[model samples]
Target: AAPAAAAAAVHEVTCSAPVNIAVIKYWGKRDTALVLPTNSSLSVTLSQDHLRSTTTVRCVAADEAGDRLWLNGKEESIAASKRLRNVLADARRLRRAAEAADPALPALAELPLRICSVNNFPTAAGLASSASGFACLTYALHTLYSLPLSVSEASRLARVGSGSACRSLFGGFVAWEMGQRDDGADSMAVQVASETHWPDMEALILVVSDARKDTGSTEGMQQTVETSTLLRERIASVVPRRMRQMTAAIHARDFDSFAELTMADSNQFHAVCLDTYPPIFYMNDISRAIIRLVTAYNRLFIKPVAAADAAGDSAPAATSRGYRAAYTYDAGPNAVLYLPREHVTEVLGLVNHFFPPPAAADHAEYFGRAASAFLPAVDPAKVAALAAQIGFAPFPAGSLQRIISTHVGDGPRVLARGHVESVSLLSATGL
Candidate 1:
């Protein structure tokens, strides 16, 4: 075993965190500076295998130049970012507190930090890039400084950077509690269930466009807060009730309830955006087309099942229930569909049939690397049948940029030194 003092001398750490897509969307903030939310929100953390942000933090010699940050291998000025500064200060405070109790620990809080972060997926494209980025950064800071912050405490530090980032600290189902405290001390995320709680849940991300969204989420939501009357009613009445029901549905693994709530919240979130003064439009025509396609697919796939199959019955009557997939959108045109693992191939096939990529687009390019093998060969006969059933034509090629096939996944994790060596920007850039 290593000596106890050696741990305090560590100067660098690397960590990776997964992106989380909210089923019950979070919009508007009570405190912009604190990144506190007006309503509690729930999200499913996506697999890091498909989408993740990796950050490496190193304590460097004190410099009058101050700390430096590089995002996706590009240098970015961190001095103007108050949120990033707050996260660093809070982590340093925690480290100082730990050293106060243990005199042997080094005084590392005063050292400057060099942070390098990169995302496998597109940044600022409504994929919760900031959430994963900040989560990874905060987690790495705690590791580098050898702080004793619990997951909940670490989540609060992450929240100061991005509200959704707090939820990225936990695996599977997570809920961000909008606390009433004025100082924002109580506003933190709680785990609803672990990643293994509901193993069959899977997600399909339909990337309508990877280009940067026309309107950023923070600016757009603030506009909605100031002008949209529907948002007021939603915050007052709809969210509280839906939060309770959504929690129940997740615990029960009831797909019908979960699907309905997911779609409803997403629809209302976008509607609130539209109601904003001057009207903010996040969903493009392609986004609307995906919504209609998912709705029709869910409706048209109702195959009657014998009651005897569901429950032993003497006179086994028939009952129909069809909810193969549920779709939700953040403040962008991309659609994330949640469904059972058994239904992944079918739902993906339906998407590929209606929204075929260009003939020239590589299979790995259209469907993410992890999902390439799962992409089923298109069947023209089945496509024709589905087209006739739903009365919707196939979209033009290239309407969708890609499909990310992932599932519920664990939270942030410290990366091994060997793994960090391969992807660390510090090593790659020789900085």
Candidate 2:
């Protein structure tokens, strides 16, 4: 009994995972039960410094209650979620296999587990919160049991919860390959580039609304599959070619090609959503306005390059005026604009001019990460000229709730066990 107690004491672990914005979005499913995708997808994992989901798992006494889970400070019935059960079962299976190979391993498999998870950002609001949530849960479980699964194998574990969650297992740019097998053994996420490979890649998440999405991803996907013919065209012809082009773009660090692919794919995915029976409208008027804003902003850089080419200027200077920003949307109204580090301040200033915050909003919480740098005011002349070019005026104040500035970042990380503030969820609600 004493040895068992000692072993249980050592079985706790805390881990956090980053939210990834899919540039080449995943829409429908091939296999609903296994959580397989209809097409391969790619995404950029956002830095956890600004957004993340943190989870802590620990073994409870055998005499205690059954396996349980608490999310965002509310206790939920763990047995009610098949996705949660599948992940827990897979982790135990791996732990048992490891223990059988090594007889010295502690016997912690039969003990009940208490898991508590929370996201720093909004949940179920079309912000890829599920990606971080499941990734953090699976990672914490793997660490708690000392499972011997590789990162790739760990990603497969995350996939059973949420399809995009698999991509969050790797850092930087990642691709979830839509494998050909029915068993889903080949369907896994692979890293295309490390976070440091493209240090200049940065993003701004303009959160239009934090309220829960009206239709969840699973239901929306099912509806699209049964009704939309465009999804068939996307799966058959569009995604595969784009996957190759996107992978190559990331490798070569070619922002022009990368931006083009990112924007086109986002548009098509939303188009497929609209083609669904009765249609699903994820983007509001605010979302459409932001899209136009990005289009005009990109065009502002085009004129200079066109003139440089007409003048037969050197290649170096002409290329410097290439596309500076790309915008993509997930299954929500929020917009994530990817840009070079140099352009963040200027573009944000434009956003400030157009989507000015409400008078009651706290100025301190308005911008995040690299965007916290004092914004150099954009020239009013430039803003007015660009607005005229797009044929749209500035939006009402508070059209956007907040903007989070982050960069490409690494995958899941285990937090130090002694960090009391970070681990407060475990005891705060008595999980």
Candidate 3:
């Protein structure tokens, strides 16, 4: 009884992980269970200051109830969840390895776990919340139990939860190498470069809609792999070449090459989706409008001033002239734009004027409209004068839900260390 009581004492850990945007998307898996991707991919980890998930892990005496989880205050069972089960098993294996190596380090070795995850962004808006969530969970486990594993090792554990989750374990530019092995032992994320490597890079997240995407990425990718022959072409021909090009562009800090590849790959990813037998449409009219607006903005500014007027009288002509920015979208409608820090304000002004956010306090709104005013990028002024002069592109209302502007950031971080009472999602007794 004494030993049980000692072991039952609640131990807690809190960690925060950033969301990652895949520049080279991972669409299909070679082995679904292991999340072994069909091809290698790369992503940029967003700052935890703006887009991230905070998770608290607590362990207590085992009960028949098994593992428990809470995502943004919603209770969920981990017992039947394949992703959670794999993540927990992986963590325990590492803990066991740690225990075997050291005689005095088995504090929370045989206890049930309760995990709580909360995201700063919309969980269902296709913002890579699962990637951040699983990354945070895996990181917290290692921190809590003092497991002897590197960040990459913990990333492999997160990969079991979601393939993209592996990329979140590294800061700034990261690549998930699709290692050629049946066991998937070699498949894991590696840092191409740290966040500081590209300090001038800026990202603006335009929340096109808070509505949940109809087809989740996992289901959509499965359908693509099974039905879309284009996916095979992508895996065999397109992605490999793009992956090489994207990596070199990042290394060289060539924004033009990087931006061009980013946009092209995103378009090709959607193209393959359409190629699917029962087509999956992730982007709607609003998304298409944003795409057009970006291209127009680039042309209007990049081309000589006379060329812009030669095209038509209605271009969004601004004095700031250059194709210094780029845009990319995931499986969802929301768009993430990359640019130099200096250009964020100019571009953001255009985004707010064109695709305005819907009016509502809204449910689970990430940053919501409240986050707009605080954008370090720019003031979301209706830009009444700028719009009238440059010609406002009136997009449909409610198409946009919110906006969050942030730069690339470091990977996962420990916010609170050692017995943090406030951060724990589990109850006082580890219920």
Best by lDDT: 2
Worst 10 residues of 3 by lDDT: 308-317
Q: Model 2 scores what on Cα lDDT? A: 0.86
Candidates' lDDT values, in order?
0.84, 0.86, 0.80
Residue 91 displacement in candidate 1 (angstroms): 1.2
Candidate 2 residue lDDT tens string, 112-208:
8888899998898788988999999888887888788788778888999999999999899999998999989899999999999899999999999
Total colliding residue pairs, candidate 1: 0
TM-scores of the candidates are 0.90, 0.92, 0.86
Provide the clashing-pair count of each candidate structure.
0, 0, 0
Ranking by lDDT: 2, 1, 3
Kindly indicate the candidate among 1 and 2 with the higher lDDT.
2
Sorting all predicted structures by TM-score, with the top scorer first, yields 2, 1, 3
Error of 3 at 327 (Å): 1.5
What's model 3's lDDT at 43? 95
* Residue lDDT tens for model 3, 105-144: 6545667787889997678888999999999998999899
Task: TM-score winner between 2 and 3, please give it.
Answer: 2
Which consecutive 10 residues in model 2 have the weakest lDDT in total? 309-318
